[model samples]
Target: MLVSTFHRCFVAVCILLLSACSTGYHGSFVERSFYQGDITGLNLLGPAQAEHCQSYALYLFPLKHSPSTQLAIKQAKRSQPNTVMLADISISDTTHWKIGYAKKCINVTADAYGKPPSTSNG
Candidate 1:
Protein backbone atom coordinates (compact mmCIF):
# COMPACT_ATOMS: atom_id res chain seq x y z
CA MET A 1 0.00 0.00 0.00
CA LEU A 2 2.78 2.47 0.90
CA VAL A 3 4.65 1.72 -2.32
CA SER A 4 1.55 2.31 -4.39
CA THR A 5 0.87 5.61 -2.63
CA PHE A 6 4.45 6.75 -3.23
CA HIS A 7 4.16 5.94 -6.93
CA ARG A 8 0.95 7.95 -7.21
CA CYS A 9 2.48 10.95 -5.43
CA PHE A 10 5.57 10.81 -7.63
CA VAL A 11 3.43 10.75 -10.76
CA ALA A 12 1.39 13.73 -9.58
CA VAL A 13 4.53 15.73 -8.85
CA CYS A 14 5.95 14.94 -12.25
CA ILE A 15 2.75 16.01 -13.95
CA LEU A 16 2.72 19.39 -12.22
CA LEU A 17 6.39 19.94 -12.98
CA LEU A 18 5.87 19.19 -16.66
CA SER A 19 2.90 21.54 -16.96
CA ALA A 20 4.91 24.76 -16.58
CA CYS A 21 8.31 23.43 -17.55
CA SER A 22 8.78 25.66 -20.55
CA THR A 23 8.53 29.47 -20.60
CA GLY A 24 9.45 32.07 -23.27
CA TYR A 25 10.16 31.21 -26.94
CA HIS A 26 12.80 32.61 -29.30
CA GLY A 27 13.81 31.75 -32.87
CA SER A 28 16.02 33.49 -35.43
CA PHE A 29 17.99 33.03 -38.66
CA VAL A 30 21.05 35.21 -39.00
CA GLU A 31 23.95 35.45 -41.43
CA ARG A 32 25.86 37.46 -38.84
CA SER A 33 24.98 39.32 -35.58
CA PHE A 34 26.36 41.58 -32.84
CA TYR A 35 24.71 43.76 -30.15
CA GLN A 36 24.35 47.45 -31.09
CA GLY A 37 22.09 48.30 -28.09
CA ASP A 38 19.43 51.00 -28.55
CA ILE A 39 19.49 53.25 -31.57
CA THR A 40 17.33 56.21 -32.74
CA GLY A 41 16.47 54.59 -36.06
CA LEU A 42 17.65 52.19 -38.72
CA ASN A 43 19.30 53.19 -42.00
CA LEU A 44 18.37 50.29 -44.22
CA LEU A 45 20.77 49.46 -47.06
CA GLY A 46 20.53 45.71 -47.63
CA PRO A 47 17.35 43.64 -47.85
CA ALA A 48 15.29 43.84 -44.67
CA GLN A 49 14.76 40.99 -42.22
CA ALA A 50 12.50 40.99 -39.15
CA GLU A 51 12.46 39.12 -35.84
CA HIS A 52 9.59 39.11 -33.37
CA CYS A 53 9.24 37.74 -29.83
CA GLN A 54 6.10 36.75 -27.96
CA SER A 55 6.45 36.95 -24.17
CA TYR A 56 3.78 35.24 -22.11
CA ALA A 57 2.31 35.09 -18.65
CA LEU A 58 0.09 32.01 -18.04
CA TYR A 59 0.37 31.12 -21.73
CA LEU A 60 -3.40 31.32 -22.29
CA PHE A 61 -4.14 35.03 -22.85
CA PRO A 62 -2.53 36.97 -25.70
CA LEU A 63 -1.14 39.91 -23.72
CA LYS A 64 -0.74 42.93 -26.00
CA HIS A 65 1.77 45.47 -24.67
CA SER A 66 4.50 47.99 -25.52
CA PRO A 67 8.24 48.81 -25.22
CA SER A 68 9.07 45.64 -27.13
CA THR A 69 10.67 47.64 -29.96
CA GLN A 70 13.98 47.59 -28.19
CA LEU A 71 13.43 43.99 -27.20
CA ALA A 72 12.44 42.98 -30.70
CA ILE A 73 15.26 44.96 -32.24
CA LYS A 74 17.68 43.37 -29.82
CA GLN A 75 16.50 39.94 -30.80
CA ALA A 76 16.78 40.93 -34.45
CA LYS A 77 20.24 42.29 -33.81
CA ARG A 78 21.12 38.93 -32.32
CA SER A 79 20.19 37.49 -35.69
CA GLN A 80 22.20 40.06 -37.66
CA PRO A 81 23.34 42.76 -35.23
CA ASN A 82 25.71 44.01 -37.85
CA THR A 83 22.59 45.04 -39.81
CA VAL A 84 19.87 47.70 -39.58
CA MET A 85 16.32 48.28 -38.25
CA LEU A 86 13.89 50.57 -40.03
CA ALA A 87 11.78 52.75 -37.69
CA ASP A 88 8.44 51.07 -38.36
CA ILE A 89 7.71 49.09 -35.19
CA SER A 90 4.68 46.88 -34.69
CA ILE A 91 3.54 45.23 -31.45
CA SER A 92 1.10 42.35 -30.86
CA ASP A 93 0.92 38.85 -29.40
CA THR A 94 -1.08 35.60 -29.33
CA THR A 95 -1.90 32.67 -27.10
CA HIS A 96 -1.64 28.92 -27.72
CA TRP A 97 -3.59 26.45 -25.64
CA LYS A 98 -1.71 23.16 -25.40
CA ILE A 99 -2.34 20.21 -23.14
CA GLY A 100 0.03 21.68 -20.58
CA TYR A 101 0.22 25.35 -21.47
CA ALA A 102 -1.88 28.54 -21.32
CA LYS A 103 0.59 30.61 -23.34
CA LYS A 104 0.57 34.39 -23.95
CA CYS A 105 3.02 36.69 -25.71
CA ILE A 106 3.91 40.22 -26.87
CA ASN A 107 5.21 40.46 -30.45
CA VAL A 108 7.58 43.12 -31.81
CA THR A 109 8.71 43.46 -35.43
CA ALA A 110 11.05 45.82 -37.32
CA ASP A 111 12.75 45.86 -40.71
CA ALA A 112 16.49 45.13 -40.84
CA TYR A 113 19.40 45.03 -43.26
CA GLY A 114 23.15 44.42 -43.28
CA LYS A 115 25.40 47.25 -42.11
CA PRO A 116 27.55 49.15 -44.59
CA PRO A 117 31.08 47.78 -45.15
CA SER A 118 32.52 51.07 -43.89
CA THR A 119 30.90 50.47 -40.45
CA SER A 120 32.99 47.37 -39.76
CA ASN A 121 36.03 47.63 -37.47
CA GLY A 122 37.05 44.01 -38.04
Candidate 2:
Protein backbone atom coordinates (compact mmCIF):
# COMPACT_ATOMS: atom_id res chain seq x y z
CA MET A 1 0.00 0.00 0.00
CA LEU A 2 2.79 2.42 0.90
CA VAL A 3 4.70 1.71 -2.31
CA SER A 4 1.64 2.15 -4.41
CA THR A 5 0.85 5.56 -2.86
CA PHE A 6 4.43 6.72 -3.37
CA HIS A 7 4.36 5.72 -7.03
CA ARG A 8 1.08 7.53 -7.59
CA CYS A 9 2.32 10.71 -5.96
CA PHE A 10 5.48 10.69 -8.04
CA VAL A 11 3.51 10.21 -11.23
CA ALA A 12 1.18 13.03 -10.26
CA VAL A 13 4.07 15.37 -9.70
CA CYS A 14 5.59 14.43 -13.03
CA ILE A 15 2.31 14.95 -14.81
CA LEU A 16 1.83 18.34 -13.19
CA LEU A 17 5.25 19.44 -14.35
CA LEU A 18 4.77 18.07 -17.84
CA SER A 19 1.33 19.56 -18.25
CA ALA A 20 2.57 23.11 -17.90
CA CYS A 21 2.67 25.03 -21.14
CA SER A 22 3.85 28.35 -22.51
CA THR A 23 2.64 30.39 -25.49
CA GLY A 24 3.43 33.69 -27.15
CA TYR A 25 1.33 35.91 -29.39
CA HIS A 26 2.66 38.36 -31.92
CA GLY A 27 0.06 41.10 -32.17
CA SER A 28 -0.18 43.79 -34.81
CA PHE A 29 -0.72 47.50 -34.46
CA VAL A 30 -4.26 48.66 -34.00
CA GLU A 31 -5.94 51.21 -36.29
CA ARG A 32 -5.25 54.29 -34.21
CA SER A 33 -3.15 57.38 -34.45
CA PHE A 34 -0.39 57.92 -31.92
CA TYR A 35 -1.00 61.60 -32.07
CA GLN A 36 -3.64 63.73 -33.68
CA GLY A 37 -2.69 66.75 -35.76
CA ASP A 38 0.75 67.40 -37.26
CA ILE A 39 3.95 65.92 -35.78
CA THR A 40 6.48 67.96 -37.73
CA GLY A 41 7.59 69.94 -34.71
CA LEU A 42 7.97 67.04 -32.32
CA ASN A 43 11.44 65.84 -31.45
CA LEU A 44 12.24 62.16 -31.69
CA LEU A 45 13.04 60.66 -28.29
CA GLY A 46 14.10 57.32 -29.72
CA PRO A 47 12.44 53.99 -29.00
CA ALA A 48 10.77 52.84 -25.81
CA GLN A 49 9.41 49.52 -24.66
CA ALA A 50 7.62 48.27 -21.56
CA GLU A 51 5.87 45.17 -20.31
CA HIS A 52 3.08 44.67 -17.82
CA CYS A 53 2.51 41.25 -16.35
CA GLN A 54 -0.08 39.54 -14.23
CA SER A 55 0.30 36.36 -12.24
CA TYR A 56 -2.07 33.44 -11.82
CA ALA A 57 -2.09 30.64 -9.36
CA LEU A 58 -3.23 27.23 -10.64
CA TYR A 59 -4.28 28.93 -13.85
CA LEU A 60 -7.65 29.74 -12.32
CA PHE A 61 -7.04 32.23 -9.51
CA PRO A 62 -5.61 35.53 -10.68
CA LEU A 63 -3.15 37.29 -8.45
CA LYS A 64 -3.87 40.60 -10.06
CA HIS A 65 -5.83 42.19 -12.86
CA SER A 66 -4.92 41.19 -16.37
CA PRO A 67 -2.15 43.19 -18.01
CA SER A 68 -3.13 45.79 -20.56
CA THR A 69 -1.50 47.45 -23.55
CA GLN A 70 -2.46 50.86 -22.26
CA LEU A 71 -0.59 50.23 -19.06
CA ALA A 72 2.41 49.06 -20.99
CA ILE A 73 2.34 52.15 -23.16
CA LYS A 74 2.10 54.36 -20.11
CA GLN A 75 5.05 52.61 -18.60
CA ALA A 76 7.11 53.07 -21.74
CA LYS A 77 6.23 56.73 -21.91
CA ARG A 78 7.44 57.16 -18.36
CA SER A 79 10.96 56.70 -19.60
CA GLN A 80 10.71 60.10 -21.22
CA PRO A 81 8.77 62.50 -19.06
CA ASN A 82 8.19 64.96 -21.87
CA THR A 83 6.87 62.38 -24.31
CA VAL A 84 3.61 63.62 -25.73
CA MET A 85 2.85 60.63 -27.90
CA LEU A 86 4.18 57.49 -29.45
CA ALA A 87 4.63 56.34 -33.07
CA ASP A 88 5.22 53.10 -34.90
CA ILE A 89 3.64 51.26 -32.03
CA SER A 90 3.53 47.51 -31.84
CA ILE A 91 2.07 45.18 -29.25
CA SER A 92 2.62 41.57 -28.27
CA ASP A 93 1.66 39.13 -25.57
CA THR A 94 3.50 36.33 -23.86
CA THR A 95 2.33 33.64 -21.44
CA HIS A 96 4.48 31.39 -19.34
CA TRP A 97 3.40 28.55 -17.10
CA LYS A 98 5.31 26.42 -14.67
CA ILE A 99 3.65 24.02 -12.33
CA GLY A 100 0.94 25.91 -10.46
CA TYR A 101 2.25 29.36 -11.31
CA ALA A 102 1.64 31.34 -14.47
CA LYS A 103 2.39 34.80 -15.78
CA LYS A 104 0.85 36.68 -18.68
CA CYS A 105 2.25 39.87 -20.05
CA ILE A 106 1.40 42.70 -22.41
CA ASN A 107 4.35 44.27 -24.20
CA VAL A 108 4.42 47.62 -25.97
CA THR A 109 7.13 48.94 -28.23
CA ALA A 110 7.13 52.32 -29.92
CA ASP A 111 9.01 55.39 -30.94
CA ALA A 112 8.50 58.23 -28.48
CA TYR A 113 8.38 61.82 -29.65
CA GLY A 114 7.68 65.18 -28.07
CA LYS A 115 9.13 68.56 -27.26
CA PRO A 116 12.65 68.25 -25.87
CA PRO A 117 13.31 69.10 -22.26
CA SER A 118 15.04 72.39 -21.95
CA THR A 119 18.48 72.50 -20.40
CA SER A 120 19.29 75.49 -18.23
CA ASN A 121 22.97 76.26 -18.46
CA GLY A 122 24.22 77.88 -15.28
lDDT against the true structure, per candidate, is 0.50, 0.80
Q: 116, model 2: CA deviation in Å?
A: 1.1
Question: Over the stretch 8-71, how does candidate 1's per-residue lDDT look in tens digits?
Answer: 9999997787565444334333333343755543356533334344444455334455235456
What are the runs in model 2 whose C-alpha is more than 4 Å off?
A: 1-26, 30-33
Name the weakest run of 10 consecutive residues (lDDT summed) in model 2: 17-26
Candidate 1 Cα lDDT to native:
0.50
TM-score of each model, in listed order: 0.38, 0.70
Residue 72 local lDDT, model 1: 57
Extract clashing residue pairs from model 2. Answer: none
Cα lDDT, model 1, residue 115: 49
TM-score of 1: 0.38
